[model samples]
Target chain A: DAPLFDRVAFIGIGLIGSSLARAVAHHNLARSTVCTAKDPEHLEVAHGLKLTTDTAPTIAEAVRDADLVVVCVPVGAYAEVAEQLKGNLKPGVILSDVGSTKTSTVRDLAPILPEGAHLVPGHPIAGTEHSGPAAGFAELFIDRWCILTPPPGTDPAAVEKVAALWRAIGSWIEVMEPEHHDKVLGITSHLPHLIAYTIVGTATDLEEDLKQEVIKFSASGFRDFTRIAASDPVMWRDVFLNNREAVLEIMQRFTEDLTALQRAIRRGEAETLEALFTRTRAIRRAIIDAKQA
Target chain B: DAPLFDRVAFIGIGLIGSSLARAVAHHNLARSTVCTAKDPEHLEVAHGLKLTTDTAPTIAEAVRDADLVVVCVPVGAYAEVAEQLKGNLKPGVILSDVGSTKTSTVRDLAPILPEGAHLVPGHPIAGTEHSGPAAGFAELFIDRWCILTPPPGTDPAAVEKVAALWRAIGSWIEVMEPEHHDKVLGITSHLPHLIAYTIVGTATDLEEDLKQEVIKFSASGFRDFTRIAASDPVMWRDVFLNNREAVLEIMQRFTEDLTALQRAIRRGEAETLEALFTRTRAIRRAIIDAKQA
Candidate 1:
């Protein structure tokens, strides 16, 4: 079968970027793939791992003749990278991303897209606490979700091509508005990561002995939070910053709920505590039924 | 070789209780085991599963001639269970438990302990979200910690026997002051559960459509919290009520830390967010080093 694209370009070879590149290469989705990283070390690692057919030192050089361009750096670096690609992209190239925050992606990349290019912003709801080029794998997106939030009026062929690539890589695709994507993920992904980071950070402030004991006895439950909190710091910082409004709004609700729970604990409201705990189990069941657990 | 104890009695047969019963049988840790539960349905399930060699109709009947009595109910029920055990306990019997809060275990069971009887409170740092006899396995405690918080001046031989049984069943043992155990676990276990329950509960309040979306996309991070939050509600309710002081204090610290992070996010203080996130990663590394992760 013919390759899906003549040349696919990756702007940053980090965890998500490298994983997608590996999937494309492993599945023969692209005839040729080239990746460039802001960190030369990452590009070197990519070379050593043969993560792509080629490595470019600069974003412009990488995307020069590419049929599909994937921006894969931290979300905060989007504007700078977009600046370099302003006039370097192929005329009809499909510009997509594997970013966490969809709104920021569209805002930063859309303005620089050439007249004939297409912008199909995507967020693959898959990752691990581990990061960098070495941490990615071809199976990272298997059976997971990939959400595409193309701004209205985007070419159907362009969006379908992006979806087809993700589907070939073992992802279920869902397309929604960029704003709605941020809101849902704000609660599901952003809030959980923020809380995990906060609780683990709190433990960091504990007395040295107590802190060590917390780690020693962490299996009970805290270990889960520590794992989540250990996710890429710069990536997460960009997520919180770029999705600030939605994150803050959802966080407000979380704080209010937490305060209520804290009060219930204080007043010895056993029934209230049990009711909430029991109710939440239904959500777990739903996730299990959805095969998302 | 002879079993570790002549007769071992369990006062409840939930997840932890049934697991211990299975472990006891699997390892020949006890010659004969009998279990009783406040809920007849649980006793019936225990009977159906053959969780113990014998199933007793009441606490008194269960502990009448047992050499070791392990209370395996929620902390809130300790006072009532202790009342039933006050005079019926075999003379010189070693009374232990697998409760979460050690201070409450000591507080509730200490007074009822006969002069010659030993009070050796234990808290096995192991469990899962599932509850009841069907959810237990003999290997649940393997590689897990079993903490013994026997009050000062207790019989050394009794404590050693308890430790020996846990070791035989594949657990590492640690002895600490009850207060210290409660404080450490408050941060490690109790606070984490509370936060998980709170966040999952927060999701439950979202609109029905959005709520379904949250569950569908939960693998991003919320799924871990849901699994933790799905743990037996009555058990966790009792945990929070019994370990009020320690849980509340740690929760206070957690809330303050969360508030600071919230302000940082609101103000776009990317460095502060990244710094805290990076620090928490060290704890995860420490846990991995300790083989607790």
Candidate 2:
């Protein structure tokens, strides 16, 4: 395969960041890869794992001469990263990201883009419940959809280049509007995580022995939620914080729908419950048909 | 290990039933094992898989001459299963079940149990998302929990016999009141499944392109819900129908809590959202510590 980028710099070496770094390194998608995280320990792990060709000590140093600088940090840190990278990026460099929400990302990072540099915000719709550099694998993004919501009038060549990089890592790329991406992901990713967090929280408040029983019997259904709820607290905290409006808007619809079902359940409305369940099975079937199951 | 019973009969040979049959067959927990399902195809699979020593087509034929009979059908099928087995069961037979709900088990099965027949209800809280006899494995219950909700004045020997069988299959047993068992499972099992079904159902209502995208991008978080929602619809339909009150009650709490978080997200109440996400993380830890993760 042709090298997709001359060099790629990773701004934060956590799960998604590390996964991208690993994929870029493993598949030789880039001629060389370098990464830097805010935490020294994480950088040390990147060094130990040989996650990239170089582990830079600071974000600016990492982006200094790279053709592609992918911001892989929490969205909450977008401004800090953008501020730090504003001056050091090479001319014609491409700035992209794997943050969950795109609108907030553009709001925070676009104004700071250096002249002649291109900004393309992307979200690779892939992750495991596990986090951190070690948790990353080359296949994490394989066959997954990566949404790139570049602002209109952005250089087509830059968008193509970034799209080429993710495609090299085995993702199908689609261009979407920033607002639409947020609204859609707010329903699919953000709301699901929020529900998992809340239900697990409800389980936590149970009496001690009952709580143990909940854990013991978790395989019935709660195990899935625990795995999800175990995801990096800081990162998810940033997600729910940064994607506030869109997340909340969709969440409103979700709650209202949930309440109607709840009332039906309370009234022993088996038909209502069964109808919903049967409809969901069709979605699962669609996922299987899409081969993303 | 001591053999727990002279003969064990299983009514309704689906995933959970076939798994218990496999466990019994593997561990030599009973002198003989027999199973039957209302669906002939499932019974044929049970026989073809050799999940039991004997297979019958009727619930009455299944329990006749047996010392122990476990009802492994859907909870909604309990009344009919109990009614069918009422006159056909041998004297002193132990009638138990592996239903998700407990209160309804007693309400449906207890009265129909014949004199000298012991009713020691049970729920071996282990399963996979898959269904049917072919999907079962002997290790399904290993290191999982088995909760027995024997009503007051229920025969202790019958309860012990069931517990011993589960123990031989590598389960830790908990004896609790039927109502308490239902409540804990309402949070852990029933509510989780309902939410999974609901969210997956919500995504099912999306526009064609968006729905396709939701499935293609499911790995973001929606994939887990798909797996859960892919679970046997009929089994789940019965679970919700039979466990109506407990599931609805807990679902009410879940929706209210979800609403508050939705409000936080809409209002951009970062603190409220972060705090709950943080608190939920602690529960995931507790579950992991309990070795349920």
Candidate 3:
């Protein structure tokens, strides 16, 4: 069978990008794949690992003739990358992304896209605490959700083709409005990372001796949060900045709930604390039952 | 090669208690072990698993003529258990516990101990989210820290024997003041669990449709918090109530830090968020370096 696309270009080859490249090559989804990153070392790593057929130092060089261009950088850098991509994209190129925040993806990339080029923003709900090109694997997207938020009246054929790319890489496809995607992920992914970052930052601010002891005894429960908190700082920062309203709304609810629990603990309200804690366990069971645990 | 104690009694055989019992049996740490729980089903499960040499109906019966008595109930139940144990402990018997909060262990158990009996409170820094006797295994304590918080002037021989028992079960031992133990754990274990419980509780409060979606996409980061939140509720409620002071202190620090991050996010202060997140990574690296990750 013919490959899904003749050529695919990745604008920033980090964890998700490199992983997608690996999967693309493994599945023969593209006949030729090229990637570019601002960091020379990351490009070198991608080249050494053969994550792409060719590597370029600039997005212009990478996407000049590519049929598909997937932007895989921090949301904060999207605008700049979009500028570089504006004049370089081939007519009828399908532009997609693997960024965390989708509304911002549309807000930043859609304006600069060339006429006749389709914009289909996406987010793959998969990754580990580790980052960088070397941390990628061909199976990274297996059984994970890859959400695409295409603007209204966009070409269905273009969306289907993008969905096919993710499908070829083993992702279950979901198409949603960009705004709803941001809201759902605000609760699922963004808020959780924010809380993990806050708790790990709290541990970091402890006195020197106590800080060392925390690391020594981290396996208790803190270790999990530490792993979540160790995710790319720049990536997370951009996520918060780009998705401020949704993140803040969810965070406010979380803070209020936390405050109520704090008061219950202070008042020795065992039943109240027990009720909330017990109810939360049901969700965990549901997650396990859903095969997402 | 002989057992450390002639007879060991467990006042409540839940997850931690049963795991210790299994480790003791596997290593022959005790010549005879007897357990009793307020819940008869737990006793039945313990018996079915052959976790102890004997099962008794009451604390009085369980502790009779035992050389070592370990209280393994919720921290909130410590005072009631102490009242029941007031006259049951034999002379020169070593009294201990595996409670999360050490200061409360001493405050509750010390007042009721008979003369010449020793008290050594310990907290093993290991456990999964699951609870109950069925969730225990002998390898639970391997390579983990078993912190002992014995009061001043306590019998050195009793402390040495308890440490030996843990050592035999492959635990590394660290002796410290109970207050200090609570403080360190307030940061490392309690706060993390509290945060996890809070965030998962927030998810539980969401609209039904959104809640289901959150679980489906949880692997993005929320799944980790759900696992922590799934931990036994009564045990955690008791932990927060008993360790109120230390937990509140650390939680206050955490809230301030969280609020700062929240403000930064609200203001779109990318640098502030990035700086704190990057600093937290150092702790994760340290935890990995310490072999506790």
Candidate 4:
């Protein structure tokens, strides 16, 4: 594989950031790599892990003279990142992001980007329940999907370079509108996490005796939701906050559907319950057949 | 390990049944083992895998001379299984079941059991998502809890024998009243699966275009719920049907709590949402500390 960039800078080195940093280093995607994270301990761990060739104390310092700049921070941090990278980015530098939401990212970062710096919003639909720099690995993106949402009329070469880098890291690429991507992910990802967090939260509020039993016997099914809910709370809070409209819209639909289900269970409508239960099994089969299982 | 039973017969050969069969076989807990299933194909698979020493053509044949009989079919078939085993079971045979719910099992089979035979209802709190004879592994029960609910003032030797059998199969045993076990499991297992099945079903009803996208991007969180919802429907149907009171009771609490959370989200009550989410995370940490993670 050829080096995609002579120099690349990372704005935040969290789970996704560190993972991509490791992947870039492993694949030699860039000749020189640098990163800056807000948290001091995280930066220390990233340095210790050798996530990039150099660690910068400031975002502007990190992007100086870099041919590529990747903003791998929480969606809420996009404006701050773009502010720091404003005049420091090299001419013709491709500015990209690995955020969970895209519309807000484009809206937040595009305004602050300097002339000759390209903006390409992206989301790698891969993550574990864990977070932090030390929890990352090069294989995190293997066989996963990386979606790019490039504004129309954006330079095609900049898009291709990012796509190629992701492909080299074992991801398949798709270009889509930011709005469509958010809506699609709202139902598949956002709503599910909200529900898991809600149900597990419900169990937590149970009477003390029942609560103890819930943990003791969690292996049944509740435990899986707990694992998902155990994911980094601040990161998730940022996700829900940045993608508010889409997440709220899908959460509405989920609540209505859940209400219907609750009524069915209350009414002992076994047929409706079983029919829905049986139909959903086919999707799991489809997922297995699609090799995503 | 000492032989726990003179003879033991498994009535169905699937993931749970075959795992128990393998454990019993590996540990020499039973001198002879036999199995039969409603589906002839499963029998063929069991026979091909050599799951039991004698693969009987009928349930009656399998239990005719056995010292212990375990009904391993999906809970929906419990009544039929009890009917079949009633007349054929030996006078002193200890009859038990490996089901998700105990209250209903006692209700369905206790009345049908022969007058002199001992009933020591048991449930091994262990399993993987996979099913079928091929999915069976001998170590599935290791370090897991197995709950037994024997009726008031039944034979102590019968309960001890069943506990010994589970111990031989590498499970820690606990004895509880039927109602308490039902209530505890309702909060732990049944409610979680029901919620998972409902949410995954909710996603399946999305528009065709969005449905495909849901599957494509499911790695976020929905995928876990799908896997849990894909579990055997018949077995779950029986679980709900059998543990109706406790399941319904806890489900009421869950629905109410869910409604509260939904209201909180809609009202943008971030503090409430964050607090509940934080508490749940603490519970997750507890589970990890307990070595159940």
Candidate 5:
């Protein structure tokens, strides 16, 4: 059978980038896959792992003849990378990204897209705490959600092709507006990461001996936060920076809720605490029922 | 291969209570074990699961003729249960508990203990989100820590007997002052659970459509918090209420740290965010090195 695309170009070769590359290779979704990264070491490691069919030193060279160009770098770098690819994209090429924040995707890349090029921003809601090109695998997207936020007026064929590629790679797809996607993920992913980072950072500031004991006894709960907080710093920094309003909005709600619980604790309002705790358990049940647990 | 105790009495038969009964039966730690709970259904489930040698309708009856008694109910119920055990405890009996808050355990339980009956409060740092008697297994305590916080002037022999039972069941033992245990666990367990409940509660307050979407995309990061927040409500309520001083102290630190991160995000201080995230990763590595990851 003919492949989905003549060639697919990846603009970054880190965990998400390399994982998609592996999935494309495993399913033969594209005739050829090429990747480029600003970091020379990342390109070297991706080549060593054979993550892509070819490697390029620049985004312009990588997307030269490709029909699909997926920008998989951190959201903060989207503007700079888009500048490099402004007029070099092939005619009728589809431009997509695997960035966490979709609003920023359209904000930064949409302006630089050449004539006839379509943009379909996506977020594969899957990953481990590990990073780098060597930390990726073909099965990372299995049974996971691939949310695409293609702007209005985007070519339907372009959206369908991106959906098909993700479907072939083991992802379930949902399409929504970029603004709504950012808000939903702000609660589900970005805020959770921020809270984890904050809590773990709080523990990191504990006195020396107490800090050692915290690590030894982390299985109680702190260990889980540690895993989430250990995710790629550069990527998360970009996520918080680009998705500022949504994150701050959700964070405001979280802080308000936390303060309420703290006040309940202070006033010895056991009923209030128990009621809130029990109410939250229903969400967990709902998540389990949704098979997201 | 004689049993370690003539008879053992459990004041409650929830997750922790039933698991301890199963472990005692597995290791022949006691010749016979009896349990009683306020909820009749819990007693029925414990009996059906064969978790205890006998099920009593009341705490007073359960502790009759038993040489060792372990209170395993929520911390909020400690005072009420202690009232039932008072004046009924056998002379020279060793009394202990599996509650999460040690200072409260000592505070609530010490006053009711009869002369010649020794108190050795312990907190087994192990559990799952699931509760109830049927949710227990004999191996739940394997390779976990069981911390004993015996009050000053507690009988050394009584503490040793309790330590021996835990050792036979494959737990590493640590003895510390009750205040110290509360402070350590406030950071490691209580604060984490509070933060999780807060985050999950924030999601719960969202609009219905967005709430459903949060569940669908939970695998990103929110799922872990859901699991933590799903833990027994009454138990956590008591933990926060009874350990208010320690919990509030640690939560203050956490809130301050979180606010700092929030400001950094608002200001687009990528270096500050990245530095904090990088420092937290070292703690994860330390946890892994300690084999607690």
Candidate 6:
């Protein structure tokens, strides 16, 4: 069968980008694919793995004749990348992304988009602590949710095209308003990553002896935080910076709740602790019932 | 071959208790085993699973004439259970426990220990979020750390016997001072559980719409915290209450660190965020190297 797009250009080939590239190739979602990265080593690794039909040395070169351009760089780097893609994108090209924060994606890429071009920003809610091109897999998005937040007035056909590609690659697509997307992910994704990074950072500052023992006995619970903290630093840093408002709001609630629990522990209020814990278990059950656990 | 212990009694056949009983039977570590629980349903489950040779209705009946008695109840119930075991233990009986807080174990079990009996408190660094007798398996302790915190001046023979039984069940034994064990676990286990429970509780308090969205997108990061938070509520409540000082101290350190990171995010201190994230990654590597991940 003919491919979905004549050509697909990936502006950055990291974990999510590389995974999508692999999936597109495996599922024949695109006729041909090309990827570019600021890091020359990543480009070489992408070439080594045959991640795409071609490797481009720059964003301009990658998106030169492509019908679709997916911005896969860190959110913090979007402005710089958008600057490069301003005059290079093909006419009527559909631009999309695989970023964690949607509001930031639109804020960064919308202004640079050409008049006839379509912008469909997507956030695939899936990943591991590992990063880089080699860390990606073709099945990473299988059965995962991929949310698209297109600015109002976007072409339905363009939005549907992007959704169809993700669906072909094995993702369940959900369309949401950008602001609501950021707020929901602030609690579900951003806040959890922040807390994990902070707790793991706390252990990093412990005295040498205690730190060693902490790692030795990490299987109990701390190991989970370490794994989350091990995710790409630049990607996460960009996420926090871009979603500051929503993240800070949820974090404020988290801190207040933590303080209450701390007080209960200090005062030996066993019932309060048990009550909150039991209530939280219901959330776990809900996640399981939703088949998201 | 003769069994390591002629008779072993299990006080409170819950998750840890039943696992130990199953391991004892599987490894032939004891010739005969008896278990008792304050919850009659738990006793019935123990009998149905054949977790022990016999199920006794009370602690006194369970420990009567047993050569070894392993306390597997929650830390909060230790003192009361100790009261019941005061005169029921056989002479030369080696008393042990599998509780989270080491200092509290020594404080509660040592006073009621028989004149010739030994007290060796243990905490196995392993478990799933599930609880109850049916949730346990014989291999729960395999390749896991079983920390034994015997009070100073405890009988050497008794300590060795307890250590040997754990070893026979495929556990690596680590001897530690009661105070030190609590301090180490305060950071590794208690503090993480508190953070998880707090974060999940925070989401539990969100508005109805957002709360459902949180569960739906939980696989991004929130699901992990949910699993940890889903752990037995009564058990964790007792943990925080019994390990108050150590938990509070570590929590103070964690809160201060979190506050600094929060400040950095507010100020858009990208360098600060990136540096801490990179450092935390090293700890994850160390854990992987230690084979703990």
- Each candidate's clash count: 0, 0, 0, 0, 0, 0
Which candidate ranks first by DockQ, i.e. highest?
1
Give Cα distance to truth, residue B254, candidate 1, Å: 0.9
lDDT (10s digit) by residue, model 1, range B22-53? 99999888889999988788789899999999
RMSD over all Cα atoms, model 5: 1.2
Judged by DockQ cut-offs, the docking class of candidate 3 is: high
What TM-score number comes out for model 1? 0.99
Off by over 4 Å in 3: none
Give lDDT tens digits, candidate 2, residues A1-293. Answer: 56888889999988899989888887788888999988899899989999999989988899987999999998989988888987899998999999988999999989988789899999999898778889989898888899999998899999998898889889999899999888788877987898899898888777888787787778789988988887777788889888788777767667667777777776777777777877777777777788787
Note the residue pairs that clash in candidate 3: none
Give the least accurate 10-residue stretch of model 4 chain B, judged by summed lDDT: B261-270
TM-score of chain A of 5: 0.98
When summed lDDT is taken over every stretch of 10 residues in candidate 2 chain A, the lowest stretch is A250-259
Q: What TM-score does chain A of each model score against the native chain A?
A: 0.99, 0.97, 0.98, 0.97, 0.98, 0.98
Docking class of 2: medium
Poorest stretch of ten by lDDT in candidate 3 chain A: A201-210
Writing each residue's lDDT as its tens digit, candidate 3 over B182-268 gives: 999998899999999999999999999999889989989999999999999999999998889999999998899889988998888
Each candidate's lDDT (Cα)? 0.93, 0.85, 0.92, 0.84, 0.93, 0.92
Candidate number that wins on DockQ, 1 or 2? 1
lDDT by residue for model 3 (A146-229), tens: 999999988999999999989988899989998998899999999999988888888877788888899999988999998999
lDDT of 4 at A161: 89
- In angstroms, the error of model 6 at A254 is 0.9
lDDT of 2 by residue, B8-100 (tens): 999988888888988888888888889998878878878988999999888878888789899988888888877798789899888888998
Give the runs in model 5 whose Cα sits over 4 Å from its true position: none
TM-score of 2: 0.95
Local lDDT at A157 for model 2: 97
Worst 10 residues of 1 chain B by lDDT: B37-46
The C-alpha interface RMSD of every prediction is 0.6, 1.6, 0.8, 1.6, 0.6, 0.6
